[model samples]
Every structure is written in C-alpha cells, then in structure tokens.
Target: MSELITIIASLIALLSALYARWTWSEAQKANKISRLNMLLALKQHYSELMLKEHEKARAWGKDDSYAEACRNSYADYQIKYRETSKELENFHARIVADNI
Candidate 1:
C-alpha cells in the first residue's frame, strides 16, 4: 500500500509539472500576440499622423496664424512619429530575438 501511494504521488507530481509548463507556454503565446497587436497599432497611428502632417504641410504658407499653428503641430507630430517608428523597430528586434 505504501508503494502504491508513492507511485500515485509521483504521477500527480508529474501531471502538475506538465500542467505548469503548458500554462506557461500559453501565457507566452498570449504575450507575443499582445505585443504584435501593439506593434500594429503603433504603426497605424504613426502612419495616420504622418499623413495628417503632410496634409498640413501642403496647405501651409500665407504666414497666417492658423498656418503657423498647423506647421508647429506638424513638426510635433513628425517628431512623435519618428520616435514611435524607432520604438517599433526596437520592439521588432526584441520579438525576433525572443523567437530565436
């Protein structure tokens, strides 16, 4: 009876280990998916901002107050877009490294 109890305990331990491993793997997969989604969102946001900045630039000139404001806003958006792009590149590199 003692031997049987020991065997059962061992089996239970093995099952628990497997369950933990599976759970960990699933969590990793979820994290990867979440990161990918964030990357996509950042890209989309940067693209939209860039397009709007371009539109503002094209409509710029005339030395009017509104034009000046638009230009300033465009410059700010340009800086932000560049920073976001750099972040996206770094994130992509990290994800690639993780896969390797």
Candidate 2:
C-alpha cells in the first residue's frame, strides 16, 4: 500500500510540473504580444506627434536673415511633414491589419 501511494504521488508531481510548464509558456507568449502592442502604440504616437510638429513649423516660419534660407527651412519642414504623414499612414494600416 505504501509503495502504491508513493507511485501515485510521483505521478501527481509529474502532472503538476507539466501544468506549470504549460502555464508558463502561455504567459510568456502573452507577454511578448503585449510588448509588441506597446511598441506599436508608441511608434504610432511618436510619428503622429512629429508630423503635427512639422506641420506647425511650416505654418510658423522662422525669422532668418536670408530669404533663401527661410524658404529652404520651410521646404525642409514640408518634406518631413509629408514623409512622416506617409509613415504614420503605413503604420496605421499595419496596426489595423494586425488586429484583423
């Protein structure tokens, strides 16, 4: 009877270990997904804010001695604004696709 009880205890311990392993694996996978979501959100937000700032900069031109420099600076902001807007759109599309 004592030997039988020991065998049962051993089996129970093995099952418990397996259960713990499965739970841990699931939790690790969830953590990775959560981290990816956070990174995506951060990227989207940062890019959007940068685009907004660039737009504002173009609206409010800098005071410069050289007219050519002023036009060049405004042109730079215009280019960055368009690029950032495109990037944000691409990222937004990706996030929507990921959700689907």
Candidate 3:
C-alpha cells in the first residue's frame, strides 16, 4: 500500500510540473507574439512616414527657397523613424533568440 501511494504521489508531482511548464510556455509565446505584432505595426508606420517625407523632399527640391525647411523636417522625421526601427529590430531579435 505504501509503494502504491508513493507511485501515485510521484505521478501527481510529475503532472504538476508539466502543467506549470506548459502554462509558462504558453504565456511566453503570447508575450513574444504580442511584441512581434507591435513591431510589425511600427514598421508599417515607419514606412508610411518615410514615404510622406520622401514626397515632401521631392516637392521641395523643385523649389529652391523651400528646400532647407523641407530638408530639416525630413531629417527630424528620419531620426524618429530610425529610433522606432531600432526598437523594432531589438524586439524581433529578442523573440528570435528566445525561439518564440
């Protein structure tokens, strides 16, 4: 009877451990997926901003006087886009590294 109880206890422990690990893995996967989605959205936004900035640059290039102002604005936007892009890259790298 003692041996049977011990065997049952061991099985229960093993099942508990497996449940914990499975829950943890699922949470981790969800978090990583969320991050990846956020990164993708940011990338899309960055692309749109770049497209707008390029259009502004092209328009201003056709006019000598407005060139400087347009260039400066585009520069600022470029900096912002770059920072966001860097963050996205970091998120993607982390997800990949964790095999998520």
Candidate 4:
C-alpha cells in the first residue's frame, strides 16, 4: 500500500509539472499576442497623427499668405517632413516584421 501511494504521488507530481509548463507556454503566447496588438495600435495612432500633421502642413503650403511668409523655410520643412515620414514608415515596418 505504501509503495502504491508513493507511485501515485510521483505521477501526480509529474502531471503537475507538465501542466505548469503548458500553462507557462500559453501565457507566453498570450503575452506575445498582446504585444503585437499594442504595436499595431501604436502604428495606427502614429499614422493618423502623421496624416493630420501632413494635412496641416499641406494646407499651410497651399495658403498664399503662409507660403509668402517664408518660402525657403517652407521648402526646407517639406523636405525634412517627407524624410521623417519615410524613416518612420521604415522603422514601423521593421518592428512589425521582426516581432512577427
């Protein structure tokens, strides 16, 4: 009877360990999914913000008075803005690719 009890206890312990490992793996997967969702949300938010800013800049560029205010400055801003937009796109793409 004692030997049978010991064997049962060992089996229970083994089962518990396996269950724990499976739960941990599931938790890690959940964590990864949440992380990806967060990244996607962030990317969408940034894209919207960038679009808003681009529209504002475009409006300013189109306005005769604003364009007349500082043509050189506006030109420089447009160049830098486009470059920054490209960089942000590349960065976000890389992040998503690497994570996935």
| TM-score for each of the candidates | 0.75, 0.58, 0.62, 0.60
Q: Each model's RMSD to truth, in Å?
A: 2.4, 6.2, 3.6, 6.3
Highest-lDDT candidate:
3
Which one wins by lDDT: 2 or 3? Answer: 3
Q: How many steric overlaps are in each model, in order?
A: 0, 0, 0, 0
TM-score of 1: 0.75
Q: Give a tens-digit lDDT track for model 3, residues 1-100.
A: 9999999999999999999999999998998898778777877776787777678878666766576667776777678778878888898788789876
Model 4, which residues run further than 4 Å from truth?
60-100
Model 3: colliding residue pairs: none
Question: Which 10-residue window of candidate 1 scores lowest in summed lDDT?
Answer: 53-62
lDDT of 1 by residue, 33-98 (tens): 797788778778867877786677667756677777777787777887787778878877887888
**Candidate no. 4 TM-score:** 0.60
Tell me how far the alpha carbon of residue 94 in candidate 3 is from the true structure, in angstroms, after superposition. 2.7
Worst 10 residues of 4 by lDDT: 67-76
Off by over 4 Å in 1: 56-61
Candidate 2 collision pairs:
none
| lDDT of model number 2 | 0.66
Q: Give the per-residue lDDT digits (tens) of candidate 2, residues 1-100.
A: 9999999999999999999999998886676567556656655665566566556656667654454454566566566656656666675576567663
RMSD of 1: 2.4
Candidates' lDDT values, in order? 0.80, 0.66, 0.81, 0.66
